[model samples]
Target: MSGPPTASEDAPIRVLLADDHDLVRTGFRAILGVEPGVEVVGEARDGDEAVQQAQRLEPDVVLMDVQMPGVDGLEATRRILGPSSPTSEVRVVILTTFDREDYLFEALQAGASGFLLKNASADDLVEAVRIAARGDALLSPEVTRRVIARFSTPGPAVQPRRPPELTDREFEVLVLLARGATNAEIAGELYLGETTVKTHVSRVLMKLGLRDRTQAVIYAYENGVVAPNGPSRDGSET
Candidate 1:
């Protein structure tokens, strides 16, 4: 199966800066200025403006600050990635000074592709935009473990529900994905082409009605498809 297509090299990744701080936006612009194959197409001072500009500019990625005057980043992200948005192709990466776990969970639920720290290096910022633009997630290995550990534990919210029927191959892919495996890694492990892995990923997202990879990971955990630190049939850690 062919995977979801990534961004092509022919066009630069257009980005929209959505932050309440003027200095933050300026700093982001300055940082992204030196990066090749990236362009800042617009800026927004609040979540409402962010949503409006997202529709108008149709940027490939949005650098959304978690805190804004009105609507806030979480709501803006939801609206931007929601079904009624002008384009569902756009991706958002949440930026925040606080590394609160709740913020990360909420951002993912709001359809954000990643969570980035405000103090992250310029290189990190540049790389994050590139990753998000390519329809890939930006979760770090540490964050991945944290997310799994947190979500895998039983809770009133973690009610078990049946997942959509997936083929055995697709189930394997989802388990590895929840375990933080990259497409390339999964390809090597499964002895399939990278494009085929992508296709499987796209199918998984489609069948699961998920927006992106991050949601798929959460779904796997919530649906009991995999457990925190559990071993799989193939002897792989979940």
Candidate 2:
């Protein structure tokens, strides 16, 4: 599948709002409407409509609600970002009033690029769109903590095997990424320039066929590349 959409430096970020509530949609539109570099391209009141509009509009970002009549947001997210999607470049940011763990985990598994609580401030909403547009995952601290906690729990023991395609440096980058280190932080730890770290990160993602860092984290844990709550392969604490 294609990577997330990239908005040019001079182009406004195109956005599609998908929520059952008109007021919620309107509120989002108002918050982003005034932003100079963001545009509300369309709105969808249900999951089916969301899927349709996302394919039709090909917006850079989709602000999706978790619960709505008909197909619901989680399914819509899968359809929008699924391998068969026509607009594979679109990034989905799940917006929900509920903070249930099931919804959070399911959203990520559905290929959502970000997840935001409905209680977030207007500024947070605007920043989320920009972040997703720039091909970054924007998980709130609480959500991020939940993800770490979930993966840190011990599962059945299995040997961790590294993908042969990744070099030693790329493997290190993936380990630090799974440990929640940012590119700058990874650079500091590895004594590499930020640009070089970014290159390693991109290479790690591309080699592993991951869509974003969030997926990289999930992949690391699931594949036992970095043991949860334990030292990495290099015998250093993650």
Best by TM-score: 2
lDDT of 1 by residue, 23-109 (tens): 999999999977889989999999999999989988889999987986899889889888666756688989976467787888888
lDDT of model 1 at position 22: 98
Q: In every candidate, how many clashes are there?
A: 3, 0
Best by lDDT: 2
Candidate 1: count of backbone clashes, pairs at least 3 residues apart or interchain: 3
Cα lDDT of model 2 by residue, 1-238, tens digit: 3455679899999999999999999999999999999999999999999999998888999999989999999999989888777876689999976557888888888788988779999999998999999998875556656777887777777577787889999999998888888888899999999999988988887888888888888888778788766877667676
TM-score of 2: 0.95
The TM-scores, one per candidate, come to 0.87, 0.95
